[model samples]
Target chain A: MHVTEDDLLKFALETCDDAEAQAIGEHVAACDECRERLALLRRDIAIIAGVQPEAERIPLPFRSYRPSVWRAAMRMAAVLLVGFVGGLAVSRWVCRCPVTVVPQYGASAARAIAASPQAVTPAPPVDLAATSQ
Target chain B: MVYPKGTYEVSDDWRDLDQARHGDEAAWRRLMERHLSRLVALALMMTGSPEFAQDAAQEAFVRLLKANPAPEQGTLRGYLTTIVYHLALKENRRSARQQNVENSSLEDDSPSALESMVRSEREWLVVGAIRALDDAQRTALVLRFYGEHTYEEIAALTGVPLGTVKSRLFYAVKQCREWLKEKGVFKECM
Candidate 1:
């Protein structure tokens, strides 16, 4: 049987699967009418494709700051800013911080005593061993 | 039949496009020279406005250079056309909104618009024939023939199923064929 226009269209588009392509291929090779029809379809395709109007050279990256370009750049910049802030927060949550909100005095009780505005006198460390004995 | 692979000799497109991605100005120019006209044509088909078409084409290149969005399934040309197509649609919407507000005529005063007005009779006839189609069919037809895209690429770009794309292609070609025959330009051009 002769191929339909749909079959020929798919063949022209190269959309047929391999087996169907082979079948169409054998048919078109042997059928003069199908071959001529394919040629005409190709010409129509060319007429459709070939109507491009001529153009001058478009200045490339020289004018890269066009709306679309910087708009994307701004978008990427915004994404990076969000990522950095998010990562900082996540890292802070995951890791231990060396410093704390409240200050702790170590071993320098005298300095702590002097530094404290409410201090009357220094409190000595209790000797637990002597007390136990 | 030994079909021509693509209407454009786009072999160097990938290599130059790769270089353009990394700040190569000359390669970028090469890519632009090779593809800009076709992209502009696509934009024109999509938007029907010459100025918007030019802007859309430039925007596509800018997106390519800046965003560097590689296609997962189609070629770089297809990717570029997809960008132009979307940009054209967006710009068309914005234009429509402004027209709605200001109530201006749809005349485009761009030089390209004037140039297209005086194009050859055959070109005008072809454009008229294409414009006669419905929006969906026209888009499918332009992408398939002018973009030289496969059915898969057209389907992906249009976000339609394979069968739908095939049907659109069938109706679009059938309409254009009938138009050409009616115009008596088919036999004359051939």
Candidate 2:
């Protein structure tokens, strides 16, 4: 069987298992096509491996800074402001009081007054028995 | 494979990185000393300029120092390499713009015979071919060869899918091989 390019690449990369590599090695020994491809692949890999990026002498003690006190304070203040505003908005939305007549006005009279346009004093509370009846 | 064994006294980079994150000066220095060459090399390969490569390496370390919640996955070297790659890409774009501006005003922008001769050297040809590749392909190739990262490690470090990493390598290697062949660099001799 002809050894595939993928197999040759893997073998070049040393990613193939030993047994698989052995099989490819055996095939490559006999097949000029596979052998040439493998040779080119290895050469390409070597060219890449040969690249030496010139190194710079980084003087010890990397000059990096921690957040200054003022910056930290500012960040904290911003967080607190956001939290406060968010809490206030949430409380207003979730805990708003229901709109209802004042307690001095009975339910029926409150409804009557609300329905009418006339300006009048709130009615006294109705007796429980009367309201139930 | 990029980082030889015993190059670092402390083997676990994450530990040193963690310490550095917590304001340990020695730990930070250790990390810098260990990975500086690799990062510089990565940037050099990407940008093809020593000055930009140095700048990219330094910038990556500076960014690393400032990074809150420092990279948690992959080796520190891989993380630094990713940073260098990005910085180098940016540097390359900026330099390309400058070069274009210069070339537009010049009557003859083509390389002279001497320049071409020097560039036709094996190393120069390889570097040129590598630089000619798209950013994604170049990055995968560098990570695989220079960083010596496995495909899985490369995917994790580069934030690409494993399949994408493999595909990038396949195309990158193919392109390099074809380029080398055109240059009459590839031969039957193993």
Candidate 3:
């Protein structure tokens, strides 16, 4: 039977059984075209096998890579801190006090203010006599 | 099957994986040393970037450690490789999407001038050709060659049919061969 490229590749890779390998070997010895194809396949296989197998050492203590507990805690703390500071600023802004002058009243309202005990201001006794003089 | 009887020494792999899961530092180190390079190589083949491959490999190990009911024995390496493969695929897809949005090429495709200067080396050329392959082909070829897994194993790892794995590997090798020839690396052999 004529050898196919698949047969040649299998033979080259040594995946074929010994009997099939022998059969292909004998066939390739006689068939010029199959020999050429087998040679090329062998070359490709060699290149693939020749790759460097060395790799860098594994980083010690397999990094589990879970989110850090401390980082989450810090994030929570940050939020609370901002809230606290913001609340303090708002309370201070709301609690400020300022002085203002009270408005004067009309005649009847003045008499009522004179009669009230909480009104402690005494009118000057001679103010009307001084104005008349 | 069963690590091919004597191809590699993994007799203690199950024990080591058990210890690693339970917080044994030395066992974890041993496991990483034994499998890191291969995992990285597999990722590199799939993602076409050394940095991204390393990241994917590291992520795979981290996930392996975190997995409940950890993977069974004699299959840890395959399990890890499969994880790395999936991670690399996701990373590649995400980067591709971002590149599309930005109207920029993937970093893998835009090597610096200094990098271009070193393309003449045989290893780099081989790697470049491997990178040029589509994801399916690259995965099949790398698992078959780098991971040294059988087509059946690859089929199981990739969740595809046996026939599809075979076809992907066949075409992957063929494509890489053609690429090598076009680059004049294997012109004399052809």
Candidate 4:
């Protein structure tokens, strides 16, 4: 029977003890299929190693980098500056020309007051003098 | 491989050793600066907790200094890797024993949403797969690949028989490969 997958992997990693190594090596030498599997296992070993934990530990200068206090303060300052500028622009626009309030009709409306000549309504005059007498 | 094949190339590793041996704090600091991150990563692999991992790594370095007066004549990287690995593995076992209930809950049959979120990014995908492995398998895998130790060294370091080490490594790699394949990492990334 062919060697087990465990044996093949061990053989590929060169971890088999002397006797095991010799036996596996002999079997692999005699078998083309085992040889191919061993090659594949060897490749797998390398691939696993590539993702090994230590591989991620390269000393990156900015790895533990937090934004400097000054930088953060500067960012806040910039935000405040932008907000202030925006608020000033809005207030200026609003002050420059308020929207016209057309009271009688169109778009925005309100009840007309007698302050306008057109708003005064006519009513019948009573005989005040005769009533008083 | 993250650790290069053979003794890790540290020229100052030896050059500064004499000073480090003579109670020079600066020399020792230099050594620690050189090797601490790698040691921490290895420990993190064995011990999942960053807190415990950091402790294990630091303890390993201190133990090497205090425990072995005449430290083994090899690359400092090798000794540090070995020490930190052992420390981390011990912590892992202790924690595993105490937190069996909590850990059992974590090992549910189906993958959790957190586990299955390893989409697109190969690093995250591989990390998830590695995390999937049980402690023993993960230890064997990390020691072999990251530590770059030979079978004999791994066996000796782990205090396990060569056969056990070989088998653990085999299964570890096999499982990792299966997980990687299942996630389509091979086709998508490399």
The per-prediction tally of clashing pairs is 0, 0, 0, 0
Q: What is the DockQ of candidate 2?
A: 0.13
By the TM-score metric, which is better: model 2 or model 3?
3
TM-score of predicted chain A against the true chain A, for each candidate: 0.43, 0.40, 0.38, 0.37
lDDT of candidate 4 over B68-175, digit per residue (tens): 333347766677787887676577667734433225332432234323422335645565566678767777787777676777788888789878887887777778
State the TM-score for model 3: 0.59
The 10 consecutive residues of candidate 3 chain B with the worst lDDT sum are: B97-106
lDDT of 2 by residue, B1-190 (tens): 4223235543457777666655677877777667776676576556556566677888877776666434445466666777787677677677744433212221222223213323236755666667667778888888787666788988986799987887887678777778767877665322
lDDT of 2 by residue, A26-113 (tens): 9999999888877777766777556554455554343346545777899999999999999999976654543334467678877898
Model 2, residue B189: distance off in Å is: 7.8
**What's the best-to-worst order under TM-score?**
1, 3, 2, 4
Q: Estimate each model's TM-score.
A: 0.65, 0.54, 0.59, 0.52
Off by over 4 Å in 1: A1-7, A14-22, A63-133, B1-11, B21-25, B70-74, B97-119, B188-190
**Model 4 score (lDDT):** 0.62
Cα RMSD for candidate 3? 14.0
Give the CA lDDT, 0 to 100, for residue A133 in model 3: 38
Q: For candidate 1, give the lDDT of residue B82.
A: 79
Best by TM-score: 1
Stretches > 4 Å off in candidate 3: A1-6, A14-22, A25-43, A62-133, B1-7, B19-26, B68-74, B97-120
Q: lDDT of each prediction vs. the true structure? A: 0.69, 0.67, 0.68, 0.62
Interface C-alpha RMSD per candidate, 1 decimal: 4.5, 5.8, 5.9, 9.7
Residue pairs with backbone overlap in model 4: none
